[model samples]
Target chain A: MEFSSKLLQNAVHEMSQLPGIGKRTALRLVLHLLKQPEERTEHLSNALVKLKSEVNFCKKCHNISDTELCEICASTKRDGTVVCVVEDIRDVMAIENTSQYNGLYHVLGGKISPMEGVGPQDLNITSLVQRVKEGTIKELIFALSSTMEGDTTNFYIYRQLEGTEVATSTIARGISVGDELEYADEVTLGRSILNRVPFESSIKAT
Target chain B: MEFSSKLLQNAVHEMSQLPGIGKRTALRLVLHLLKQPEERTEHLSNALVKLKSEVNFCKKCHNISDTELCEICASTKRDGTVVCVVEDIRDVMAIENTSQYNGLYHVLGGKISPMEGVGPQDLNITSLVQRVKEGTIKELIFALSSTMEGDTTNFYIYRQLEGTEVATSTIARGISVGDELEYADEVTLGRSILNRVPFESSIKAT
Candidate 1:
């Protein structure tokens, strides 16, 4: 779109460079900023710049953190011996929200997607192997999504920890608690049947 | 959502404040930025700050500009006597894209929407009246949307120009060029029929 001002056009161009945002959307966002108080724009820009430049990643888990170690890694209350492996910080946040697992986390940053040119070396796999070799972790839970890339990443890590004495397992895939079995996808339903839990164990949750 | 870093949380919160963006999308965008090179984030932030702080509006038409007068207003090729009144800069860009009209524009900034607590005084209506009073404009075309607020704004401006020598007109509302008559809304179809142009006049354009 033709913008009257070069500054406005530049802002829109930069905004549209973001994933999922188009030129029209960028224009709308820029115009919205233009209509608001100058401080709002200043706050947004400053926040983005600060987040990019000064943000720190946890040395232990590779998750976003303000300190050298993330909160979960530093917390003595959490089960440091049990580590939940995830693709990114969002997965860490999602699992944290559930409050179901109390283990420490290992963020791989991303899965092993060959089609996307992302290999095992591209991720935080080397550090994860180092963590396992240190012999502190007892159980390594594979909590990545049930996709080919996720499975590949899990296997790659499992191979790296071959000589280590850590127990490795994946999170169970089954029908959601409230979802109707009939409405479930065929693959999920089939998997749930094949990986059926013990009757007494399922009953104890209720 | 709980973020390990306060900086990440602040950036996500600010990003979510933009129209049509939600918390999840905001997180996705923030994480995408975090994964990219630092220069991308710096470019986006710097451009936004520059645009917000340095952008200017045309003195005559009130459209966004880098100078006192906008390109359209300063151009000798465009019809200075005929002015198109629009809601905002987007409309100016939309009309410019069509390349159908060679006239100047006057941006109203926004329509008079009582539901949103926006009134005539809140807009650039006063400057529009001042433009009309200067007696250079011979025709004023209302190109705002076909909403109730748009009609209200047009009528309000028309009333303001009651004693002026300029002729006023609204852009026609009808079936779009490629739209089927069967699918056209009743009001639009009825209006199109009522304000039907002569067959020869319509045929001449093709």
Candidate 2:
């Protein structure tokens, strides 16, 4: 698509570089910005620049933060001894929304996907190992997705903790509470049955 | 949703202010930028700032342009006497892409919509009238959308040109090419029937 102004074209070109945004969408967004007051565009640009220049990662957990440590990592209330490993900050937000886990997070940044050239070293695995070796963590919970890359990353981290005394566990895989048992995939259904909790324990939660 | 960083949260808030973008999508886009090299974010920020601060509109046609007059308006080959009135620059690009019309364009910037508090005074309608009053323009084609607002804007302009010697006409409304007659909307089908052209003239075009 041809643009009437070079500046408009450049803005759209940069916008379309983002994931899932195409040129047409970029043009629409740029045109929308053009229609609005200049202050809106200034705000957006200022925010992006400030975010890039000022944002930092938590030194302990690798989560996005404004300071040396993320809130969760620095929180006295959260259980630092139980680190829940996740793919990214979004997972941290999702898990935090549930309010079920009181443990601190260890953001891996991403899963180890060989096809995507994302290896164990490319993630925050080394720091995670160091955290485990510090002997403060009692249990490490694997909270990544149930994909092959997730499993591979989990196994890699588990191997790294071979000599450490930290106990390792994974979030349970099962049918959703409101979902029908028959509709559950075979792998999830089979695992739920094989790892079934005691009847009394399940009854107590409900 | 809670954010680990205030800077990240602020960025997401500002990004979400854009049309069609929400907080969740804003967070995703911000995180994606965070994952990329810092230069990518800087480039995006710089482009938006430059576009907003430096972009200019064609003085004659009101199309977004780098100079006083747009390329089409300055072009000697384009028929200056035949002016096509459009809602915005996007319509100009759409018509240009068709490669059918050789006329210059007068971008009204927007249609008159009372619901949105937009009136003819808010648009480039006055400049259009001035262009017609110059007596250089022999024909004015209303190429706005087929919506109620588009029709109202068109009629308003037509009234402004009531005493002018320039001929006025609207772009045709008919069943689109390759469209099935049975599936066509009633208004468009009815208009096509009422404004049917000579059979020989239609045959000659094909």
* Top-TM-score candidate index: 1
Give one digit per residue, the lDDT tens place, for model 1 in B1-206.
78899999999999999999999999999999988999999999999989888889998988999998988999999998999999999999999998889989999899999999999999999998998899999999999999999999999999999988999999988899999999999999999999999999889966
Identify the runs in model 2 with alpha carbons over 4 angstroms from their true place. A180-184, B203-206
For residues A77-101, could you state the per-residue lDDT of candidate 2 as single tens digits? Answer: 9887899999999999999998888
What is the TM-score (0 to 1) of chain A in model 2? 0.94
DockQ of 2: 0.82
Please tell me the interface RMSD, in Å, for model 2: 1.0
Question: What does candidate 1 score in Cα RMSD to the true structure?
Answer: 1.5
* Local accuracy of candidate 2 as per-residue lDDT tens digits, B1-206: 79989889989999888878889999999999988999999899889888888889999999999988889999999998999999988899999999989999999989999999999899999999999999999999999999999989999999988889999988888999899999999999999999999999989966
| Candidate 1 residue lDDT tens string, A1-206 | 78889999999999999999999999999999999999999899899989999999999999999999989999989988999999999999999998888999999989999899998889999999899889889999999999998888888898988888999999999999999988999999999999999999999977
lDDT of residue B124 for candidate 1: 92
Instruction: Report iRMS (Å) of candidate 1.
Output: 0.8
CA lDDT of every candidate: 0.93, 0.91
Candidate 2, residue A47: the lDDT equals 87
